[model samples]
Target: VLAQNLVIQSSSEIRKPGDSVKMSCKTSGFTFTDEYIHWIQQVPGKEIKWIGRINPWDGGTVYSSSMKERFTMTTDNSITTAHLQIDRLRGEDSATYYCARDTMSNQGYLPYKNIPKQ
Candidate 1:
């Protein structure tokens, strides 16, 4: 099985739609760039939500299908931080944002054996 971790990303600013926003996730269980970082948003009265995510090693981003084209995601491996920027202001942009990263070990990550198993 793969290993797992829990990282809490904290931010000091609440960004508007047109303003740029960034957050950082410091891993406590493993190395920094070995995994992926994901961003989420939950409304005032809703369950877990998905907004976007970024990969630190290559600075890759994946946004939700329903999100507008304005949302942007980026990451800096050197600092172990992820950034979420949304351009153009809109009332709907007001939300509680969350940032998360994939643990080095996952629940189903298993290695193969060199030989057949009995």
Candidate 2:
């Protein structure tokens, strides 16, 4: 089988706490709808945070409690893309973001299998 990679893209911007930003993840070399796409956040010199995840096939999402109020997860199967939108950004929100595939064979499991970015 050919290897596949997940590509994430977002423009860096300077904004205040109330501002919002949108980031995207596009997949290549595999069936995009076959896996779940997850978003992650990392503040400078801090641990990684799990933002949320989306099912590309149906657009369903589940977010971390810490992120429920300001983070939204979405996906477009037609474009093989996933998106993360953050609203009311705070100073603490300044960080590097990433998109990764949830490679767990069983959806019932909670541990991340592997994260390719951030």
Candidate 3:
């Protein structure tokens, strides 16, 4: 699927320890089910972690080894949106998060990139 003029929007959140954080990725300029949406986390001074991805076409998802235990992935194709929710916020979760569209080829990702942390 060609994703010309694709745009994704998500907001920052403020949460206390042990709270849950639900982040959304609203998209435009493409059919939501035409591609997969992946979430990633970049903790300050650390490498990026792949949270997971959802197949809007079938509502199937895959999470990273570390994140699968505590994170959830969902989508609402009707709204052209995908979501990532962290079950328990810890100090380690203090970092920027991002929603990306898998370019669906060997060319690699062409995602929106960064969003503020919770």
Per-residue lDDT for 1-118 in model 3, tens only?
Answer: 2356355556557787788878777877767898988887877789777788899999999889889987999998998888888877777777777777776433433343343444
Model 3 pairs in collision:
none
Poorest stretch of ten by lDDT in candidate 1: 109-118
The lDDT of model 2 is 0.69
The candidate that wins on lDDT is: 3
Give stretches of model 3 more than 4 Å off: 1-3, 104-118
Q: Sort by TM-score, best first: what order?
A: 3, 2, 1
Q: lDDT (CA) for every model shown?
A: 0.56, 0.69, 0.74
TM-score of 3: 0.82
Clashing pairs in 1: 3-105
Score residue 70 of candidate 1 by CA lDDT: 73
Residue 111 in candidate 2 has what lDDT? 28
lDDT of residue 64 for candidate 3: 90
Give the residue spans of candidate 2 off by over 4 A: 1-3, 104-118
Give candidates' CA RMSD values in order.
12.9, 6.2, 3.4
